[model samples]
Target: MWWFTQGSCFLPFFLVVWSSTSFILSYLIALFRRDVDVLFPYISDAAANPPESCIFGLMTFVSACAGMATIYSRFKFVEKLSEETRVVNPQLNKTTLVLGILSCIGMCVVATFQETAVTAVHDVGALLFFVSGVLYILLQTVISYQAFPHESSITVCRVRLAVTVIASLAFFPTVICAFFVKQTDLHRVKDSKDYPFHVASAVCEWVVAFSFVCFFLTYIDDFKRFTLRVMTELG
Candidate 1:
């Protein structure tokens, strides 16, 4: 259809909107239910209980799937560009795809395992999701630089670099503060001695997560000019 032919941009756009909506909606629900403090709560804390848990799980799972599709499409786009430009490293392109896929898988794991119900598993999932996601974007930024003045503009590269750096800088504090946070009660985190650490970690987490959404937003223009097609053959 003509719409599909011109709608490649929709993938990244949907991802940005959908993932942001999932987080925001879950946070609002948690706040309304008093499941979490009005102060900054860890992303997981915001969706740790039902029925918010159920909503968060389903929404995040769909977002993860959309993320996977968007990443795969990106991989294909870069591969095609490489074939045309001969400037892109084939190995790097493949590696980026692997990292992106792993990140999406991590997102799925995070969605499936609720932190309060399965703390260890959820933490592992969050680790995988955040670490891999950050690395994926960093690699993608490098790729964008490599494609510079050819398939990409200097301004676009700078924007991607900025986002990557912000996410990377926030990541360390998010992890460190989260580790030192001794508040076991999510609702009473603000009342705990470790409240500052909890708030710091949560704020950093949100920063990193939104950084991801902003990074994907940069893909919209590139995606706009590229369209995917499926071919079937019986041999």
Candidate 2:
């Protein structure tokens, strides 16, 4: 019952499953309607398409839930550390918690304001989600290393730290390149459909999304150790 709280390890797996399924399904639906070129359309384009937009909105809401669950899990981990040492570091924990909450709220905003309905609000929400994601990755990597310094894999925590850094670094330029190309294609190129630059931008966007998802793998091993208890017996 306690593990059923927001911090449940199962939450990450659920987040991953729902987010991935919704994304893939939205893309497929977009393709079915001939509204987007599956190979070249931006992920957001799927959300802009008819019917599939519903799936996209669902994904964003699920993402928001994942973010909140992450905050709770991180808070619990910090509390565990403090309990062991009999000392609390409120500032760092609080900062991480706040960032996670902001990231979740950003996802909600993105969901509420679809790109077709309100481009500016959607863009702002997306930016907030991503910027906070980058910061959260950096902070969590540091926290993971400091929290579990002794993990073996010649240091599993260190490997995960490296991965988080690399993924975020890769995400940074891809997002910028994608945004720049998309903007240029929309305003200047005019023949944006499946154009080389357009395709490149789409690919970059995909890479950024994938890299962010991969960042969560840093917690996979830890998730394995989480305990779950049954609270009620079947009648």
Candidate 3:
């Protein structure tokens, strides 16, 4: 109730907490079940088993929904700010929204189709989610810079830029290492000759995932300044 009255800021905060909890809980469950090795695991590896898979799927679905809502709210907020500041960029705003939507859809796809079950589809979903999500944040950072002094602060813009850059840096290694990792067992990659590559990829995947979470955390402060409303007209 307080969150409803205060502002849409809570959306991003909720997204961060919920998404982080989903991954952590899933990881712990997988570890407890011995479904995955104690070492670094690809996010999908942690959720590929029976019990953890079920929980991970449900939790990730909810997180994806929250992510979509947060992205849409940010899009609308930026659109309003741009109008007020006379720094119109409707095309960019729309493009960001499309990217955000596609990324969220990818998240849903990943949640619905487990990597162990549907490997190809799952990998595609992951690629879609990671690439589109990174591009979305990068575009948002650009927009933040564009709105500087008028609708946003230089500090916030810089922070976003840093997060985007880190995610981007992590993204490349994630893809590259995973490509090189040759392992028969998905759950236990430590025995493989390419174990180092697997470790690098898994670690980088976690970094990119958490970086996406942190990016949403940056939205909390800006979202606090605005509220969303739905209006109805009687015809």
Better of 1 and 2 by lDDT: 1
Ranking 1 against 2 by TM-score, winner: 1
- Model 1, 110-203: lDDT tens per residue? 8889987888988898999999999999999999998877767899899999999999999998999888887677775355778888888889
lDDT tens readout by residue for model 3, 176-211: 989887684657645568989888999999999999
Instruction: Say which candidate scores most in TM-score.
Output: 1
- The alpha-carbon root-mean-square deviation between model 1 and the true structure, to one decimal in Å, is 1.8
Clashes of 3: 0
Q: Count the backbone clashes (under 3 Å) in each candidate.
A: 0, 0, 0
Worst 10 residues of 1 by lDDT: 1-10
Q: Which is the better candidate, 1 or 3, if ranked by TM-score?
A: 1
Model 1 clashes, total count = 0
Task: Report the lDDT tens digits of candidate 2 across residue range 1-235.
Answer: 6443333556666666666777678888888887766466777777785688877887778777875886677577666666676444657777877887887787788777877688889878877877776677677666665565332243656665676666576556555655546452222344654356566656655665665566665455565454444588789
C-alpha lDDT (0 to 100) for residue 228 of candidate 2: 41
Candidates' C-alpha lDDT: 0.90, 0.66, 0.89
